[model samples]
Target: MNLEHFDAIYQRAAERKGGELALESMLSTPLTQQELLSITDDRWLSAFSMKVFQSGMSWKVVRNKWPNFEELFFGFKIGPLLMLSDEQWEAKSIDKRIIRHHSKVMSIAANAQMIYEAGIKHGSFAQMVAQWPSDDITGLWLYLKKHGQRLGGNTGPYALRQMGVDTFILSQDVEAYLRSYKIIEGGRDTKRSLAQCNQAFSFWQQQSGRSLTHISQIIAFSCGDNRM
Candidate 1:
């Protein structure tokens, strides 16, 4: 595919966002691999659960009730959550302290089980994530979608990004840029489209020496109506 140079994209984003300094200030960096390794499995579970609950609901509402989620879910500790009986989980669904969505609430245990198994296999879920190859980030997304509940599509990627994984989100603007360039086609969830996105971002990363997070943000800011 004939992709534009990262420099041109960066320039476009800078101009749109009010010059280089302003755009640079807006870009975010992912945590270092070491920092990712330092995170515990429960925090990863919590991030995943938070994203799942926020999927179709108000983000501010989820954020406001996060503490209740933490408390009721036993601080999202993988072992404790995995051991909860069906009745116990059902109780959590009706609890007044949380969102009370039964399906989303039940997803907590399923995802917790997924995390526990991953921890057993990889020392910790964080190790698996920290050691995942950045160039093949789409593979990681696939893994989460396959193994975890309510983690398909952007849900898993958003959780990963929140927890400092060096992954790009196919947000509306990013998807628009990809579609406009013919870098990807059809739905973003398909393997072919996602692989194409990975290739495009990998190329830009090589060209710019920037993280996927930065490249993704620049692409969004360069196009779309997000500019100031």
Candidate 2:
């Protein structure tokens, strides 16, 4: 059931969305260099932390309390945040401002440390993300999972997408499309599923000269989901 080419995927998406213009609007666009440069390390940490907390929770709850989380984490400033003791983090975990998930609260602290290290080692976390090769975005996902805490699965990719990094998100519709094309197994979610999907995407990048973001959107669009 795979489309013959990228243009076929685009055409199916356009038809599914009612017209070409509508499908164009649904495509994910990466931010410009100036805009990406404007994003600070603190903000990057916040976005990562937010995505970690948003996992398996109501996004509305996360969004509603985001300002409070920002305030509590001291604007997610790496230096001051790295100074927090375990007791301090545990204390905040029980606070009423943000979600009270203790492990997720601790993930904020852990991820902040990861960000601080990335900044020191790579000039800045933003630089690492901006300069990472889009041709191997799965590597970025792997790095996040290994270096940062609790960033595995779709969370890492989704966060990258939110930050305007060129990456793909394997939503259900996208997974279905991948399975239809024999890119991934129809079996349960597994490490093999991720590896195969990543390989398939890298192959498509070589074949189409398009960003992972665009390819992922086209596949999801082909499924007629339209649910970002």
Candidate 3:
């Protein structure tokens, strides 16, 4: 129930691994609210599309093919992406320029609309994402899943973190640590499990005044893994 217990675990793991945890080295890269709020629309779309294409696929493959994706999607410009006709997107299925997952390719349009609408309402899409309470990050995750295409489960949180938002990513190692503490029970991917983990993180955040990213990184380090 104490965050110090979690810190002890991370320290032991770091000692065993013969180096500081990744989070330790990231001290200078703290993600601030102002930084997140300043992110541009293109970056938001790129981050979202990266997470979407990365789902259930090799990250290396996605990275390798990203330049082509950028070209095909017009650098993920929201306006051009929205203006792309259905036939244009359908043609991408057969085009060698990008991954041919039909549903994922189609998601670009749906997600574009999601961002566009948010921008219309909030002055900018970044405002919407940046203004979300980091203490209730799961709420933002729910909104992304409900509003954006192909952004269910881990995609939203992963994308948000990549966009420099202060949020936890429930990776396997993080989930394993949560279970080890009995904070969550059963399989790690269930709604109930996530709720339990979120509550624990919320409590710990209040106590420690740490960002969710740092806390999640500490948990993963405690497990002696950092694949996320």
Candidate 4:
């Protein structure tokens, strides 16, 4: 269901309520800026995913930005991602609804080269990530490329970072994907930290003796055909 796609952000939502609960269940955690950038010739979809998270957007991330971001990243030219100029960031910082941190704005502009380079270096960025381990961002990149809603191609990389997608070489969306899969059932998983949310999913594995795909079936029902 659509909830699986939301697995990454649900943890942040949980934190606003801050209560004592088990934390050992943290399955995946957010990566550092350095770690996010450390990703090498990995997921192209992630690169594009980041592009969708533009530094100057009304929408905060991949969800709504996908349609617009998709339209912008066309043909892997990094056109949209590269287009962000320094002036834009300065103007956007005061934006109330958006994540206006300057670091995020600068990162979006700077990441264009990396995203474009990765695609050229690997021949097919999607294939490059798909070749990597499933738990890594590569898997998320490929899966989203293959399955997520095809927006008009306008994801803002800047917003993507805020939303928790790894902006690096497609190595960070891993936890997000894991979280999405866990979101199939939004109980304890929804209340935990990003790490804890992921942990709950793994716990479910042990308790239910099922795989992510199985959980997805229930998630599909929960989402009423994955609308939200």
Backbone clash count, each prediction separately: 0, 0, 0, 30
Q: Of the candidates numbered 2 and 4, which has the greater TM-score value?
A: 2
Candidate 1 clash total? 0
Worst 10 residues of 3 by lDDT: 21-30
Number of the predicted model whose lDDT against the real structure is largest: 1
After superposition, candidate 1 runs with Cα above 4 Å error = none
lDDT (CA) per prediction: 0.91, 0.82, 0.79, 0.39
**Where is model 1 poorest over a 10-residue stretch in terms of lDDT?**
219-228
TM-score comparison, 1 vs 2, better candidate:
1
How close to the true structure is residue 210 of candidate 3, measured as C-alpha lDDT?
74
lDDT of 3: 0.79
* Model 4, TM vs. native: 0.31
- Candidate 2, superposed: residue stretches over 4 Å from native: 1-3, 186-195, 206-208
Q: What is the lDDT of residue 84 in candidate 3?
A: 77
Q: Candidate 3 regions off by >4 Å?
A: 1-4, 19-23, 26-30, 186-192
User: Which one wins by lDDT: 1 or 4?
Assistant: 1
Q: Per-residue CA lDDT of candidate 4, range 97-216, in tens?
A: 444455654443445455555568655443343344322332343334334333122233222333334332212243334345553234321224323434444554455454433332
What are the models' TM-scores? 0.97, 0.90, 0.88, 0.31
Q: Sorted by lDDT, highest first, which candidate order results?
A: 1, 2, 3, 4
